[model samples]
Target: MRYFLPSKRLGFLLLALLLCGFALNFFMQAASLNMDAMSVFSWIGEYYWLYLAGGLFFFFLLLVFSMILPSVYAGSAVAAVLCIVLGIVDYKKLSTTGEPLFPWDLMLLKNAGEMSHITKGMIPPLALAAAVLLIAAVVWLLFKLPKIKVSLPLRMLFAALSVAMITGFVSMVAHQSSLAVSMKYQNIFWNQKVNYKQNGLLFAFAGNLRQSLIEEPEGYSRRAIEEIAAKYSKLPDPVPNVQATQQPNILFMMDEAFFDPTRLPGLSFSEDPLKFIHEEESATPSGFLLSPEFGGNTANIEFEALTGMSMYFLNDGSIPYQQKIVKMSSLPSIVSILKERGYRALALHPYDETFYNRNRVYPILGFDAFTSEKDLDNAGRITPEGYISDKAAVQEALRELKASSDPAFLHLVTMQNHFPFTKGHNGPNTISVEGTSPSYKDELETYTQNTKLTDEALAYLQQELLTLDRPTIAVFWGDHLPALSAGIYTDAGWDSEPRLKHETKLVMLANFNIGKEPLNTLSPAFLGPTVFRLSGQPMPPYYKLLGKVQDEMPGLSKQVLIGSNGALTAFTPEQQQLLDDYRMVEYDLLEGENYSQDLLF
Candidate 1:
């Protein structure tokens, strides 16, 4: 029943505690997330007011608790402990996934049991021990601190002022402030690493909190979607002659962290890791694929490829698999179109079925069956590097193709080459790097060796399909580049431009002779329509429009959209109109009342 009030001495000590808490939070977050200390410090200095407001808010909460607590130090100590715990969790999350912690991640706590694999190895034993010691020291200090008394009326007034100040600070950070405008740029839509690296984790999280809410697309309504769908309905339908009685078995494989490292300038490997790919590209339909993500966010590329929707239109760092696809029959995807054409669509991934909620998402995408890591193992398949090996994944795809007499569409997502390509891991180290630092060289070598294994698997799959009597086509591409050590490109004298960083290899190989025609560069959004074209399958009205756009645009992402001249340009009026129509249709399907379902499906 003792009441303690804030004094000048206590206020100064509390302010000092708040500053110390923030410092610890920043340092821990930076170290755990592999961020540059200097850059984080600079960001903090530039946005000091935001942090000051945040500090005062926390300090005010402590003051309210100090009214009932033994002393102000007790409340301060409690707040410090909570911040330390938060820092540890954030550090662990960033270490496992290159993605920094976002506000949306808090919703994922419900699935913590499923995320044990990802959350493991986040806190080292030494770090855990240190945190424990720090918490204990703070608690011991709290007991020795002195307490002050204040009148009840003054305490009530102080608490009200604290609440007002907190509200003012939050409002400033959210809107109508100069710092808010600058913070918006910190969010580089396609590349979240830059956002976190430049703005610091706290600001990045705050920015994403606003982005997490799904906003209605401009001009999005039931009537608008119907009108857009009707306008694009006149586009040419699939050519009748190309639609064979028996559709070819379609296999689309997204190799994890797979890219051609030989693209780096002045870089020579001990041997060509992608020798098979190079040989096949010469005789097959091949081109560079521009991905919307780098380092991670594999699911976003998969979403674009299957749904024929552009991530550029969505919020920055949005995970459509987790956020958009909530119902099984909502989103119309390529899988649904193929199923309508009597093709049995099967999805395969050699990892936990629950990662990114794939177990739930695949069915929503219209896959008849999803064979995940557990399913593969139940059937007696082996996994390499704690993942389903590419070789094993290909073998499963072939099995699925043969399982049903009906023409099949196999969507295989491989995970043998997931990131953290540390030194002396998963390798005979067949490839060597010349220009990069020793650490980068080691990581690159590991990545190259795994990719080589992936190439061998592709070659095996191609040969196996060739032996089969049924005509089949295989589309192979990388989801994104690996999360290699920083400065790898700068060290190799390669272009550090965003476009170059986002490039990955794409190849379309068919068993029957389709003639060796080269393809233009493509984004993942265009890949679905391109597959329908290559397979000679009839597509929906929206797809027909998308095909036309692909013919002109070829490749488009938030970072760069290919012009008719084959150069990056701001979308021309015509191009913008096409994109606007596309966006309207996408909104209709994903967020609006699904007005275009019958037309698209």
Candidate 2:
């Protein structure tokens, strides 16, 4: 035996395979809520065969990569490293934002500036241990693992076989409902957290693979959409606004990670952090916008506000910007409505234009001009985290508004108050928490001041609107709340349940009286029509239909629907009919053959 194979290569390979399999599980759990180690072990033990499937799936991927590369060692290392990096990124995301980074989320790596915060304190104990063991194996592979020479023909054949195997296995896992069912898989669209927990990381990812393939709504047909369009076109305007002297220069600001920190049960500050916005809320038509996303994922809310559509109707966690927006010829939006009325539609964001595929998506959405960080004169004025200040963002936005005398439809997505609420980022703490640990103070301090800066930014914007002498209405609201600590919401005695985590403040103020009908808590989808109505501009048939939806269901999302009475209620028969109508229009416009485009937009 010593003469034949002294190196014991078979034993080494087996050991390495076992280590890789176990690492995948660790990474999956780390990517989730750092799920308790004992619980994870118990689950693995209970479903050992299913866990084996995950390992084998990952092994197949490695085999494919190994065959493709010049050397098996190099290829396997590359594949393994990629998996570990993704695991770390997901771990960071779940740690801060309480959501695992999905496979589609890999597209976000191009905008690595926003991901820097994830690099800090991202590795947990399990990941660290896994890394230590994996590194040693990697070192052995580099130095000691012998490369067995095979013929070129044999190598090519193996590569092709490996590719075929991987394709077939993944396709089976993604498409076969029965296979997934047998292994206890499910589609928890409304709550991915629960989905991830129920099915471990690999299966959850495989589940998303199936979900990513867009599905046509039941009874979807061109004729059905056309009929739905015609019905809504005939309804009376749901949100008829007070007539303005002229169409108001609608200045919409979707502030990033903005919310009242004081709203936390035990939080307080030396003075009000959101003083200006607080005053504006009381004076103007203000309420909450039950956002479709929590922590972060601004594009979803942005999409809803621009186009009178809800994410509720689409697959969960689907980014229309990344997934669908660019594929369509044109989608009707507030920009489309305003542009037709001789307004120069501008989208200004104080961040990378490519961050959310905005550079590509904005033009298609009917923006005359899309300005981002690179285009701004004050792009360099950034916070410690490199997010552009709201001060600079507002200045650039005002400059643009003044430049174009045409009735302007300006939308600015500010970044000053974005996440990674690191301690001492603001130099000194302005906010205090009564029951929070000392560990939580730094993030709170940064978050509160960042919010305060947003208030100051609002003041600047409002003052500029007054000086313009144009009938201007501004809708300022948080894109979503900051992803603070994991148990922060629960620790505080606030009534913010998981569903309410999606709630963010909405304030619509103007240099003129925009409205006074108490535009209480509504979804962002309704904001477009609300603003259009405020400007006294007639909405297209699509918006008219949306206005009706708003009348019936003021706040709508897959998570919760706020009935007209301003409380969560099961859909009435009338409400269900309205929703069916809304869904047909949205699907027709976004994914379906645009049979209703002629009649709706």
Candidate 2's TM-score: 0.90
* Model 1, span 1-601: residue lDDT tens: 3344556875676567567656654664464346567755665677665455445556665566554454656655665566555555665545544466666556566667745643333346797798779878877776676655566765666667766765665566544367556444345544566766655555555556545323566877777777776777777765532455567998999999899988877767889999899999988889888898877778889998998988877866688777668544557888888888898999999877877778888888889999987776543223333456788899989988978798899999998787556544454676776766665677778788888888998999988998766788899999987766547766655444767778899998878765566776789988877777766776678887788778778778876677656776676788788878887777677777778888666
User: What stretches of model 1 exceed 4 Å from their correct place?
Assistant: 1-48, 60-100, 106-204, 212-218, 238-243, 327-329, 378-385, 467-469
Q: What are the TM-scores, per candidate, against the unseen true structure?
A: 0.81, 0.90
Q: Model 1: which ten-residue window has the lowest total lDDT? A: 377-386
- For residues 1-601, write the lDDT of model 2, one tens digit per residue: 2233423553464457557756776666646647467777777766665577777766766666665777766777788788877776766667666677776787788978656653444445696898889888878768776864444565566568767866776676677567766776666755677877767777777667756424567899977887887787787664456766676788889998887777777666778888888777777788887888877788989999998788888876688887778666688888887888899999999777887789888898899999987776546454454577888888888888888879899999987766657665534556565557787776777788788777887888888888886788889888877777766776775334644577787888778866555677789999988777776777788888888888898888876778877676688888888888888777777777778768887
Q: lDDT of all predictions, in order shown?
A: 0.72, 0.75
Clashing pairs in 2: none
C-alpha RMSD in Å of predicted model 2 compared with the true structure: 3.6
Off by over 4 Å in 2: 1-15, 22-30, 45-49, 117-137, 144-154, 177-191, 210-215, 380-385, 424-427, 431-435, 494-496, 515-517
